[model samples]
Target: MSATPAYRRGMADKDFDFLHGRWRLRTRKLRDVMDPTCTDWIEFDSVSEIVPAFGGAGNVELTSLATEPPQEALTVRLYDAGEDLWRVWYLSTRAPGYMGPADEGRFADGRGTFVCEEELGGRLGLVRHQWTRLDTGRPRWEQAFSFDGGESWETNYVTEHEPLGE
Candidate 1:
């Protein structure tokens, strides 16, 4: 067998290669994203497109949530070769002129978990986004928040990506 390529051997450009394509996102989220006690939930169908950019050093996901008034969201994932980690930034039509504090982490054993601090409703807390089963036909993404400095986490958002025309 030949030696493994550098990008495949360590954290490099190909980390997000599996996500490049079109996807159908079935999303379920809490009505109040910051409220751990909130049980009210909303489900919707969204379409997403992921394109590999910067020669696979990064990727971008554009999602259109089919909710009332029709909203759109964008996620940009960039890999830091030197740091051997990835940083994800998010932007949304739901929030005007906001692109955020990136969640940073590296993928291990087919799972990727990233965390960042965010202020929701005048309260600063920890936000986490996880990507799992990415090598499968159906990959999953989930979001959670913790108010007590990562002591606890409440999952508020989840989406399973079904490959389009697979």
Candidate 2:
């Protein structure tokens, strides 16, 4: 038997490394009534810090648009060595019950995609985030969802993230 290759040596130097530092996210709701028209593109800045407690998890925080207090709670993301993927979980005060679980897929071409498949309001919904880094030190985040078995997709949110000046 042969040993594992250097490139495929678990989650050491994979696409997960691109998630380090800070980012600006554009969140969209594709399946809701308020979505598809309103609140499509909201601007917010986010910072992702590596936590040693959870095996270098990506803990994120951003300002909330609906609230007046300023910022929201920390959304958690973990890099699983077993699956070689990033898993995200977060609790929303906007939604009364249930939780959000998102599975992330990163491409070698400097693009990333995340899909959230979980129950919301007793119904099945799938939300996805498409991200790409541009030449101007800015990244783009787009939100889309499929309700019918990946047959169709609806655009909900689209926002560009510009790097914060020091």
Candidate 3:
């Protein structure tokens, strides 16, 4: 007999429902990703709007950052029904036609961990994005990179998401 919990066996398509609507995001990012000793951090604000698509199997998020020169980005998330996982892709105005690497994972116990391989300063690295605090009114997201094949990680970016008009 299978002992896996039903929730783990089949996650609902609405797993990302909490992310819908408008959010005000505060972000702190490392100024230099390659420098392990770099303590310089850049703080910025951004507004994000997310909407469901593909009959709940997909979602799209548009973000506009309040940086000095202003910045915009889009994230497309598609859920693979066959694998019961979600794949995320990012596109930023700074990088025009280039779509970043895909981060693929599934939410478990209200937390989501997505990982992908990326190139940081001409060196290969493993990137991880984690979503937590979903039960709280304000959810949090963090990004980390590991150069030693996941043996260690350096958190480079963090975003605090506050629901707008709440």
Off by over 4 Å in 2: 1-6, 10-19, 22-59, 62-73, 96-98, 120-122, 134-136
- What is the TM-score of candidate 2? 0.64
Which candidate do you rate higher for TM-score, 2 or 3? 3
Model 3, position 60: C-alpha lDDT score: 98
Candidate 2 lDDT over 30-112, as tens digits, reads 33433445543434444433223344434454334432334454556665555555666655556536465666654445667
Give the per-residue lDDT digits (tens) of candidate 1, residues 1-166: 3444576555456878888999999999999986667999999999999999888989999999898889999999998776677899999998879887999987878788999998977999899999898878788999999889999889999998999984
Give stretches of model 1 more than 4 Å off: 1-11
TM-score of each: 0.90, 0.64, 0.91
lDDT of each: 0.87, 0.54, 0.88
Model 3 TM:
0.91
Which rank order by TM-score, best down to worst? 3, 1, 2
lDDT of 3 by residue, 50-130 (tens): 999987778999999998789899999988766777899999987899988899988887898999999978999999999
**What lDDT does candidate 3 reach at residue 124?**
94
Q: What is the lDDT of residue 33 in candidate 1?
A: 85
Worst 10 residues of 3 by lDDT: 1-10
Q: Model 3's lDDT to the true fold?
A: 0.88
